[model samples]
Target chain A: MDIEALRQQYLQQLQTEEAAAPPPVTPEAVAQYVASDGRDDVKICQMIASLPLDRETFETSVRALLDIAADKSVGAVARLAALRQLGSAEFRAARFGPFHAEYIDLLRTLATDEDVEVRTAALERLTLTADPHALKLLSDGLQKVGDALVPAAKAVQLLARDDHGSALPIFRTLATEAKGQVREEALRALATDVKSAPLFERLAANKDEKTALRHIAAVNLKNISPPRFAKVARKLVLDENEDDKLRAAAVSAITHTPAVAEKVVTRRFATAVKKLRATTRSGALKSSIGRFSKVFGEG
Target chain B: MVNVSVKFPSYDSQGRAFVTWRPVEVKLTLAGAPAGASNVPVTVSAKSSAGGGALAFATTLTHLGTPSINLNLPANGAPVSVWVGGLYPKASASYGDVVLEVRAAAGNQLLGSQALMVRVRKNADDLTAAERDRFLSALATLNGSGTGRYTSFRDMHVGGPPDLEAHGGPGFLPWHRAYLLDFERELQAIDASVSLPYWRFDKAAPNLFSRAFIGLPDSLNRVQFSAGHPLLGWVAFGAAGIQRGRGVGPTTVPALFSEAQTLNTGGSLHASYSTFRNMQGNPHGSAHMSHGSGWITSPPTAPRDPVFFLLHCNVDRLWAKWQWAAKLHDPADPRSFTPAAGFPPGHRLNDALWPWCGPLAAPRPTTAPGGTLAASPMTAAPGLSPKCRDMIDYLGTVAAAHQAFAYDDVPFQK
Candidate 1:
């Protein structure tokens, strides 16, 4: 972060060019590079990159990027290049405090930059911060369909991270109203929401629905209401036309609640699985049933 | 040069005095006293100067239930051994935050005084009001309202590249051991006296489930933290406040395996490491699920709420207690730990654990979220990129095995 020290170090490195030593990264001095108007940006970037950092300065390296990155007058390429350094592999170990006021202020300012590339980059970073502003933007984007800062599925996934209290209302609406991944994501986040028992019931039993979604619905239903899950799991296992994987997942969820699994898993359920396994040849499903049979003590 | 100094008959491998929230005993000794000094009548007392801990004198270690007590030292200059206890400090304390000063005097004639450096990770319910406050303050500060190092820790779990290295395999226990260590080290960095407290899921920890503590959620599963509680502003994944369900309260045991049942998992006291790690499901997963439903139940989202650490700490403790009972700290023994063979790359006994493993391709999760495993000032058993084996033999039961931290119940043995 100390440009003066970097200048001094650059000079020292140039002076000690021993035979085995690699060439100095860039002859362009740091001071001139910072002051230049794009004539020496590449060399300057390389020169700054060459400096070594210990644990103490690792954090400062992140801070230093803020100055170069926030300079609007600077070329977009140079600013973005500086910002991207924060994401470097080694910087993953950097101890920079991401919540520092200056760093946050920089992110807020850039979230709406004129350039779309920079704007999207900043928006993604802001979303990860879990900032309320990012939440609103993401929420609005999901509601308005095409007018989104991020994809609806991605938005659902990010919204799911809210732990459901804040996202519950949106998810409850999406669980029934949204389509495909967004619907599945919304339904998945509601795995613990007891209020959605009916939705879980409807989806878990809808033979026409995709097995993946139905399986998730079954798990969600099982977690919230084990008895309800028991009722559903028993029925799913007996239905010869039901998806094999869903049947397997149904049995898996039942075993999670042994008390419920006990009442629901009867001689009839065992007979049903044996009958289904006879007609089923899918290796994964056959394997799942085998495991289920052992769990139910029918092995 | 007859001065007084505080000493622990027990010490860390470094000869330093370290202790958990559980009581550890210490003694008073005289230095440079004349050879014939006998029946040296002196009054002795101890107190935490920084106000996060307390001291008391008791005849036996079990009598540490009270905040203050009287000690009966010998009538000589000889070293008298006694209990050195913690949890007297106020809440919001950190590691090394409690500097206990033990002083001796002959009726106001100051003979000598010595300061003992100590830290404690106490049960959440047993924490003094001051101790609890310190823990919350330090944790809230670490969270920094959702943008601090805590976020990085939250990311390390749940989702990562190619695999979920922290769960469902032989690596589960050790992976979380190192994970909690990294997190606790970071918390300590915020406040030295702040050690991660364990949430004994088998017991009803009402204080922990309170809104004032980890925050009890409302009817909608929205955590209702007490007014101005540090976590009131908590945010993760763009959600403000914790979205935890009103789970089974501290009263009425949730469906979790007791420590005894969990330790005696394989129909025997000393089960193989593979059989023992099944704890990842019940007590581990079941404890997470016992909350009815919340981020804690799912692997990827569990770390969002701070309770995740405490829940896992008790899990780790169960493992530690089992290790102690089975004498299975030596990883070289096949029973000590399951071999990494046939498991994922990072799951290998000697493979560096992820995130701490830095950036490696395939088999291991990409983009290690929390840099390296934190180095402890106490000892250096687990390095920057610690291997799964490094987390085993936690107390160094095997000679020269690296040691990281200690538990109040699990004593440090040479």
Candidate 2:
């Protein structure tokens, strides 16, 4: 037979089998499908979605999914499906009130699963709980690498909505050390709270830190407290030993703070320009100075 | 009257024959042959009871040419000698008694026959300690040789521009696969009994870095061989010098090898092309980054450090394990490349790897002057393409590359 005809026949066979398969009636049957080794994940997920979410069935199904999610031997895809099932609103609304601690514990363990998808699924489930314990779990997951780090950092952001103070140290460490989007998320998280000012000040003043991190800290600090950030920004702009990149960041930070005095900003620019003159008259340096002046509304 | 004797290392201590697709020299000596036997045509044929079945991808004699040799039969008991070589097994060939038959052309009479019980096993880490020692000794011979072949392998990494087509995309795994096979082939040519050993980084094997094996550099800050080491005379090719295990702060290695990252990145067949590539690239790059600086950290100069081979072997082992766990083969799609901007020309499933010329051309030197230190332009070693091959051909070469060897710790399907 030709390839296309064979494919058609195979599809017909699958459709017949799928049509013949009975819908899972009891919670035990659904749990069996969920925990079945090497079964099709999409089919399992579809079955889960079709199951009636009556109170007793919902509790039984939550227990089964939790068991699968906790079983490290299960394949990551299957575990992820289980985690997603547990996170569904129906499951949360049905059993999470009575079993909140057990659910939180399961999520906390899964948040560090060796599989990224499993960890991500657990973190997603944790977010749905809106429990304060998730804040600690999300903060701990920041040290994770690869794709999991992003979600963990994001969970911190979501949790920050309720508890910004708890996420401050986690955001500070991530802002200084994390790269790429995770760092970006942490910076965004820190900017939401005025309490982040002390950490931001330390990060901004850390000359040894990456210029991007220092810049992010300075920018966020300005957003948190303009008057205090303006003083720090002025000191950074006048520091001759500071990198030109960070100095430029300081200038941008000050420009955004309308509360800073124009005279103080002008004085900082004059000191920077004088330092640039002493170093070299290169076109790059001259342009940087010009750009700084422009940001401060001085020609 | 004719007398024939066949000589070769037919089996390991475990009673397995020398592996297939690796060169094994069969020496022949004729004594007391009839006079006027000069320039006699001799032919050798080999057969195996295990291979050549309907489902076999490699036959018993896939690449084994009709072994023909011209021999002058000795007169009055004087010895006549000829060597019959260039024999390799097919990739899909299985364990069996490989029977080699020799015949004289004039009368087509049987001159001699020999049979070897050959069995292909996993990589060297699975070998017995005695077997491993022999393998290490053979590797040392290859490393110590003046043959520009070893230097050429290192130079291939160093001589090219920083972005040579070997890395940073879907081709990274395939390119390294071909390169490792080439290195293995060279080692086998020296001694067919030897195979590349994998270093399991997840498990601490500090002994691998000792002077007895892949000798450590004098200091982490310096990338030179330690004093009294076998590779002390070895010179750095394109690298500034060797630097390893220095300045790699504590966290990177642990972070890179975190269980969640390794499995998530490597364990899924459903991963997007960029996701899988990035996942593989993360640990691969982090391992390089964690090895301190100098050769290990630099793309163009990594191969100058001997540790690079073992590290890559571990990476390859991980790929193999991943494939087995996920039940996924490499994506056959022609468009499987990284989606990131500014990446060098992405490779398709059939794209030719740059700098690795096919079996004909010499490896291209790094664009930078003084990158290569070979006394003369080095040619591609036998069974290796001088030009980089397309992914299909590379897959073909290494499809069963791991068949002849297995890792002790890797959980790959048998």
Candidate 3:
């Protein structure tokens, strides 16, 4: 088949009937437009699967084809076909370079699509292109996020791995006003690795919150470091005369977590024992001591 | 604002000098209250915001009934104030330290204060000798031999005539209150210093319950309960029903009458001397009601607050009073253990009957319609049985017996 010639012919057919755009030349036209093998079965499958994603009902077709491609283990060609369905082919161009430059808009649209999978794909493609501007687009898309902000926040969290500074604000806002269940989940999203330490400190200082909130914050902070997290824990646990219940909570929070237990366990446990002995008339302090001892001993 | 001096008697306990107080003489003024002051109606709240806090009771003060607020003490002493809270009808922020004062209406007036600080302090401890005796007296009344069953009550459920229709149900709230009051009156007549501290279970429980259930204390030590612990579940369900179906508070947060209930009764520590258990436990004793009416077996903690000793005094006293009231109604009345509602009609014999019910549930025991014992103006126990004075005398007799047992134990020859 004269594949390139047929493609030109369809392009002219579409232009000739400008008002009607010739209703997206059928599957036959599509195969002709992209140039397919008439004989080799594997080549025929690849040709059928590699159809452009910008034709009429291309999104719907591309979605169904992608499902098939995924099930059948289609490779880079299917990824390219899926990328072309985007409003801008920015992701595709980034994946394949200026060879597919005419499809830049489709990729750009995918970069900002509400679908988490689409946005993630676009970001992954941008990573390959070494495009500094694509990173800005990811950051900009995050900036104006609406209710989709939860997924947006998750994506930004990943973005933080490379560009941590830009995603920090979104993480902070979510950590603050999100509902109790939401705040709990957001903690995991925002407090990955060692970078979540400062956010933990900010949450710890929020007095308007209930003891449980403060308790969780102290825990997250302790997860990040040694003497520093231990120091904050010490202030709370060693105070001796604070709300004993709250103090005990702070002690348990700071002493038991995975990261800082080794560094501060002995000191924190000893201090907790001493303070509990000195102040608690209710025997709660001593009970707290046993808890710390177990955690430190186990650790 | 009317400023009045409310005085309470100062007493010595184990070398510690303590004075008690109650909030009364509340003056209603809209001038300095929070926003919507004019729109707000007068509110009267008597509460204790102590370490183990609770709202004692609340009611609108319609008007000043008397200049002297009478309080009762254990033993036969004059009714006097341990502490008192009152409003200053004539004092204001503009008046510069001219606060209202509360003082003992009688006696040396050793305890007197015009400041809210002193009132709060006095109300905080919740223990006193008078309170102890009051509870003791109630126990004595209910447990007295001649007056010892549920039907001993000849009067209305409360102060009205005894009606078989009402039975002992919610209508018994006021009835129980009156019974407690009668017991309180008797305690006062014995020792005027004794007074009853009304408890508001709502405010006192928040911190306690939060610590017990939500916050981590020790799981065993925590009052770690939900709306599922059978008895408490009933209370929660009942209170919730009252609120939702009947427009009560959104939450069925019960008030804590005791500090001990919160701190001690957990896994690690067994403090049973707390007020929460005592107050919550009272209604539980009614077999006619639910068995676990939430009555506590003991105090949450030991060496309980001096207040606990007094609170129990009234509790024990009320039990005694109930016994006396029940017995006075029918000496042969055996319906004590029967559920308020008997078995299905036409069943001549009760499916379940107390030991005494076999005798009372017969035509022989049912007095004629106009018979003297049946239609007598007085519903008290027979003169041959026990008079009120005889009952009091018997209580003293029991006291003597207990004292003798404590002092004179026989030694076994080894």
Candidate 4:
């Protein structure tokens, strides 16, 4: 029961009124707009459950929503709305769970719909099930830049979820050839594969590289190879000439890597930190000291 | 009358319960117990000071211990200590609720009673059934189908007129801190035992996304809750329900960066506010993007979905943990903060945050959403016109700044 139900239970009642009821909704009023042939699929979806009519009308309304989802001529908004209404708690609870297989079939068909929204929504829903069917669609789409169902980057992102782990070639190609969100996501996917450790090291160490990508490389280096991460991190933290922000990331990596932090960050390193604190004007360099101070017993 | 005072060593200066899950040490000193009342057995228990079910399971202690305990009050009247460790996750709405009462075990003679101040924000997954229901009902009431006070919050995040001050800058973390606090305080105003619960998007949160809870999504990405779900009456701009679903990204669970990855966005063990703030692109931006087609995919339309609060709460939690771990509270310390040079007005350290401030001219959003900041029953450090600098020391660690809220995982430094 809600807090409101607790009211008036005692002589010293803590009575609070219930919130005002939402203005009445007339599902029937909206259902009148639907055509028997489901040409008005959008309106049919809006009031599918609360039809107030016989079971046949409700069933027809349900079928209309599903039909709209598959009908390419209906376009994105109406099609997506139909799928949404069919997947809603009301419809799902109305024994729509049995349509699970049928729903997947509809999604499989829509995954390659001409409209980006339709295609993307289909792929996203399919990705949730880790369905093998999406694997081929995403993979085949990856090889083509023009006729692709979705952008190569989005395809790589969704494909990275594959249970088969078969997207490494695609990830490598995109990581090298792509830019922006695509390359970034591809690099993230590549980081998990040990085979790409060397690439991570090169990017992490290259000073001329974009700081964002370098940061990703520097962090993943710890997991890829602890000794290598320590060596790179130690050099960066001590490099007073380096960008203070990047140096902060280096200091962070060593301090957080328990396995190598103690071995690499010795008493001499503590002296260096103290000296750096006294001389370095970089706030990022100074800010990186707190966690290091605690772990190494430096005040 | 038997006299006694309760002191929870773990409580703050305001004497409120900060950690609800753990056994907070409560010590009682017998001040004016009659001399005739010598070494005798007494029962200690917790009840609602205002009388209600808000404190329902409060007496249910951990380790199979009963709510009321039988302990002997020594003749010497030395202070007696008892651990108040119950899994009571709800926070009191008003000043507070839970009160401690002592009675003579024999004749059931009354002693003294004191209210236990509880006001804590908790994890959504950790909430008990009763606590979850209270939070949901209070949220529904506050929304009142989009016509209630929640519109103020939904409007605050649209981020157009004020130069998007709340995002893409140093103020993002601090601004959202105030936003979530204001929203949680409103919920508490409706029912004291309700604090906003956060969704740990890094983890697979079954409880948070279930139909019985925040609601699951349909095929079209429309969120669906079970029938009679309190959130059913949810309305935004007069429209009902929320629009959200899994993104076209890989897997639902790992699509966004994990907390470990996010905490070290610099790809190291830790990072500075300057570095970690870059998460605006990954986990933070990616988390929003992972919702696919929904109001949450972008800032201007984000808060329309109630999950926006939960999402931001976790973001704030990360900052809190980072601040705590690195001792990054002192705004005076140069190492504590470094906004990009020429960061927008509100993003600067001492500048007043908007929506919380009184209306202003062209530079500010043409319309302020919630009036001034909502007052917290706990503390007044973060005033109505809070500045970016005020939010840094949230735990009141080094500064007696603001202890308005506490997370289950982040312990109070005090």
Provide the RMSD of all predictions against the true structure, rounded to 1 decimal. Answer: 23.1, 22.6, 31.9, 22.8
Q: Of the candidates numbered 2 and 3, which has the greater TM-score value? A: 2
Candidate 4 ranges beyond 4 A from true positions: A1-299, B5-111, B115-119, B248-251, B265-268, B339-341
Q: What is the per-residue lDDT of model 4 for residues A184-298, given as tens digits with 9 covering 90 to 100?
A: 6677556456677788788878888777567656655555566877887788778877767677656644554455575588888878877777787766566556545645766
Residue A197, candidate 2: Cα error in Å is: 65
Q: C-alpha displacement of B216 in model 2, angstroms?
A: 3.8
Candidate 3 per-residue C-alpha lDDT over A1-299 given as tens digits, one digit per residue, 9 for 90 to 100? 23234434533443344333112223354434333444343443344433322313334433443343232233434343334222121111112233334334444555555554555555544433324555566556556533232245444433443323455566566676776544643454454345667767766655566655565465455434545666676666666544555555454443333344455566545755665656676444454444455445422
User: What's model 1's lDDT at B151?
Assistant: 76
Q: Give one digit per residue, the lDDT tens place, for model 4 in B37-89.
A: 67767788777654321222222223233456777767566877775543233
CAPRI band of model 2?
A: incorrect
- Which portions of model 3 miss their true places by more than 4 Å? A1-109, A113-135, A145-155, A163-199, A210-220, A223-225, A235-292, A295-299, B1-414
lDDT for each residue of candidate 3 in B1-414, tens digit (9 for 90 to 100): 211223322312222111111222222222222333223221222222232211111132212222333332212222222222222121111101222223233432323233222211112123342333233333222222112121232221211112221111222222232333343333333333334343222223232123222121221111222211111111110010000001012233321212222211221111211111222222221111110111121111110111222233333333232333222212123332223243222111122111112223442233211112111111121222111122221222222111000000010000
TM-score of chain B of each: 0.76, 0.55, 0.24, 0.77
Per-residue C-alpha lDDT of model 1 across residues B1-414, encoded as one tens digit per residue: 555566765544444555443344567666666666654444555445554445444545532434544343344556766654444333224344445544344444455544444464557777766567667766755664355477788888854442257763577788889888888888766555567788888789888878668877654455665533545435465444455545567584764456655665223463688767656544565576566445664556677778988888888888886776666788788898876587766667887788887877864665767677876665565778888888887755464433445554554332
Off by over 4 Å in 1: A1-299, B1-113, B160-163, B399-404
Question: Taking chain A by itself, what TM-score does each prediction score?
Answer: 0.66, 0.48, 0.39, 0.69
